[model samples]
Target: MTGGTGLFISFEGIDGSGKSTQARLLAEHLRSTGREVVLTREPGGSPGAEEIRALVLQGDPERWSAETELLLFTAARRDHLERTIRPALARGATVICDRFADSTRMYQGLSRGDLRGAVDTLHALMIGVEPDLTLLIDMDPEAALARAKARATAEERFEDFGLPLQQKMRAGFLALAAEFSGRFRIVDGNRAPEAVAQDVRAALQAQA
Candidate 1:
């Protein structure tokens, strides 16, 4: 965490795609190699953001609109950047986050409704920098949802989206990765988690 420009990396994927597991593994890999890493996630990484996370993911799904959801996500991101991301980066630590701006642009943006306006607004207002590297873990959303539902106590609002919509969402993620070339990596999430982590490591190493 000393003397160099900080690098910010973010992971994105459909639910049950195992990006969270891989993100932790990636953090450990970086740390073991003597890199200072801060692993965090959004709609989280801060107290206020955690509360927002519960509301966005676990609350009554039918009651909230697309705009409401987007605003809540950005609200959490603002806190996350100020409280955790900035400080860690200022120390030159590599910051890996579970989800960032891309998730909202995909899930709440393209999938739920037209969020082009919101995206533009937030892009202007956010930390004013994008991830140095973003991994959009690519997995079929149906497979992901099935895996998630099998392990769930109950369905959250997000899990209720049908398979067809989830597939569309997966397409949305692919489109995003295409929109940004080397800066984004799409990992095959259907593989074993460690195998996926290996791919992530390879991708990051190429950049370094």
Candidate 2:
């Protein structure tokens, strides 16, 4: 429904919710079924976007204000859509993105301030697209934060925001799922990866 005949699936949640792993698993499963699958992540999908990703993801939490971060993320998403997502979907390939605009809605829109209106306006003007299905991996903030910190990656800027931010984000994502219940599927992420994956596949099938 998003692009031609292809399916656009996005994985979203708080930091260390295991959505990325689930995204990869879903891509592999689709590919095994002989469907063309493009497994990608936001903030750094295309070359241009990848450059912006480094700028936004690898610094102190206060390095960029919420407004500036919103702009940077929107720019990255635009480039990603042009160079990666749209093309893949137009070609009838399934696109499994690690995160999408829902993230912006929470991180920039609500986390820093009440900028949901601005985020929505820019999204409509620039992106104008949403995933056909969004898989929300719901998890406890404390556990999720632990997992995120365990990664210790350079792109841990969001993770470095600590537990309170994670709690806020988890609540925001749940609210978002309700806001877009038509296309959003909530998956319990506290279980093992394989079990969670089974639920994810079930959600996709139900969508079909």
Question: lDDT (CA) for every model shown?
Answer: 0.84, 0.95
Q: Which candidate leads the pack in TM-score?
A: 2
Q: Compared with the true structure, what per-residue lDDT tens digits does model 1 show for residues 1-208?
A: 1223799999998877888898999999989999999999987999999988888887565668888888888889889988888889888899999998888888778888898678768857764667889998889787898977776754367877758767887888888899987689888998989899999999998888
Model 1: pairs clashing at backbone N, Cα or C within 3 Å = none
- C-alpha lDDT (0 to 100) for residue 12 of candidate 2: 99
Total clashes for model 2: 0
Error of 2 at 13 (Å): 0.4
In model 2, the clashing pairs are: none
Per-residue CA lDDT of candidate 2, range 17-94, in tens?
Answer: 999999999999999999999999987899999999999999898999999999999999999999999999889999
Error of 1 at 194 (Å): 1.5
TM-score (all chains, Cα) for each model: 0.93, 0.99
Rate residue 180 of model 2 by lDDT: 98
